[model samples]
Target: MQKDIYVVGMMVDERGSKAPDVQQVITRYGDKILCRNGIPSPSRERGIITLTMEATPEDYQRMEQDLKGLKGVTVESIHFSQPESFQLCENR
Candidate 1:
């Protein structure tokens, strides 16, 4: 049996961000982040980024701490999905 974990987060950039900054953040997280979407504001003073990540217990713990340390970035909300059982398929 395997455990399934999900972390959903809404991110705000207090100072706003350029395309490169958002790209860097995605690159930094790499494969741990399963999906991400961005909404650009017409005001150009704010941007919203939503992230969905597949996390292990350890990964979740680490990101919770590390996300706050991101410069010019704020985490608006974080939701941890209820634990679920998963079937593991081993081929070999």
Candidate 2:
């Protein structure tokens, strides 16, 4: 099956209060994550995190569900085709 590239965006309000918990959740799913970038709002009260990953629909849904359960957090995701698959190539 072909896998699409998924980009997940997460926003956390009251970041100082919620960052530890949020980071824990993100760490739990670290294996599935290809790359991650996080930025804080000018006032440092809010944070935005971006993640690029490869996962099955089920896995993605599960992750999203977990994140959504967190208070003061919002999540959004977008997926699209890419020229390459996330799978590693085998030696011939």
Model 2 C-alpha lDDT versus the unseen true structure:
0.84
Position 63, candidate 2: lDDT? 86
In terms of lDDT, which candidate is strongest?
2
Candidate 1 lDDT by residue in tens digits, 1-92: 22334545545565354545555656666677767777877676667777777656676566655666666566654555544554333478
Model 2 quality (TM-score): 0.80
Q: Candidate 1: lDDT of 76?
A: 51
> Number of clashes in every candidate structure?
0, 0
Q: Quick one: best TM-score, which candidate?
A: 2
**What C-alpha lDDT, on a 0 to 100 scale, does residue 62 get in candidate 2?**
82
Query: Per-prediction RMSD in angstroms?
Result: 4.3, 3.3
**What residue runs in model 2 are displaced by over 4 Å at the alpha carbon?**
1-3, 81-92
Local error of candidate 2 at residue 17 (angstroms)? 1.2
